[model samples]
Target: MSSMLKASVQIDARGARFGALITAIVFSVALVTQSPALIMWQAAVFAIGAFRGPQFTPYAVIFRSVVKPRLKSNPIFEDVRPPKFAQAVGLVFTIIALIGSLLGSSVVFSVAVAAALAAAFLNFAFNYCLGCQFYLLGVRLVSPRNSKITLEVK
Candidate 1:
């Protein structure tokens, strides 16, 4: 695995965990009547983030931005590829949720919300990245050439 992917996975776990916990709390407290605005906002954020690719590249940019001796000596993040599998999974889920929401299916909406929560928890609780796994599985199944770039962690 590239160092960037590894570092982002660690950081994403943190973001997902925190984001999931708060969303779940809000969901449970409000029950089935949770605000649609909040739901859409969160979903949009995830979709956008997934689409745009890694949001944690700043670490690399920061490292490269400065010429200080200490900054140059430090090695916090490795040269890693962005987690494509995770991004694809998130994108697919987002698309599904969007379609369901448009169709006015409460069940679909709920599932989408739950999926997001699960994703967040999965990252934080188990450090099991469904996104990365999904992406890898997808690439392997669809394109052999693409699979060459995917990292398999043992």
Candidate 2:
């Protein structure tokens, strides 16, 4: 990991989970309605999260301002990279969904949105972060010399 990655911020896992729930809900609505606008909205959120950092993501901001203040539980901290990676994954799927919607390919659109929704639902419902797993797998494969990358990132 680079120094920036080393210094990368941590996130409140509770807030992240809450964000996942919101993401799932949004995607669900989009999937049901087949709304390109909704997919674009989510795509924007994912882009911001992936590029600017997860804290700046729309739902994360909502959680920080509206939800976190009401919660009495202690904050569960985790490295931000995994969630950031997750956002990038979401962005990819949303883009694909948007493309499919624009091109009138129901199969592609549904599959893309559904995949993203499933990932978000998994994160929200079971705390099974598929993107985080992929990120870990990537680190393990790409940085075999730094086997501690996972530990360090976490």
Candidate 3:
């Protein structure tokens, strides 16, 4: 029963893509406008996603309630854990970017935001999740016996 319940709560791949698109747009706007507040907001969103899970994230919620319903086909689902871990990674980057902006360090701020933007772009454009890959790698390193480290849609 527990296993069945777990299988039923799979993460939606389309929703993840929507999240990546939203994140990329936010980061791009922040970079272009040099708006620290935007970066901070993005950081907060990522933090919420990481701590509370993606379903509660603003972009994910929008995707679930607004976007998913409009789609003609069924959404694909994957393990929820990897994307949650990925959100944590995004939070770390955005925090660093926010700190750099607050410190008035343009170099640090640019580099951090650029790196984050690149990752987000990869996810949005190519459907490649750098943070999710990192999570999987960490899981594999720490628990070689666990076969669930790979991020495959079930």
What range of 10 consecutive residues in model 3 has the weakest lDDT sum?
145-154
Q: Write the per-residue lDDT of candidate 3 for residues 93-148, one digit (tens) a residue.
A: 89888889889997888788888888878877898866546866787788757445
Please give, for residues 11-123, the per-residue lDDT of candidate 1 as tens digits. 33333333444444544442367445555654555554566534333322332344323442333431123343444454565556666777887677678766755765565
What is candidate 3's TM-score against the reference?
Answer: 0.80
lDDT tens digits by residue: candidate 2, 61-88: 8998999999999999998877888889
Native-to-model Cα distance after best TM-score fit, residue 66 in candidate 1, in Å: 24
| Strongest candidate by lDDT | 2
lDDT minimum window of 10 residues, candidate 1: 72-81
Pitting candidate 2 against candidate 3, the one with the higher lDDT is 2
Name the best candidate (by TM-score). 2
- Of models 2 and 3, which has the larger TM-score? 2
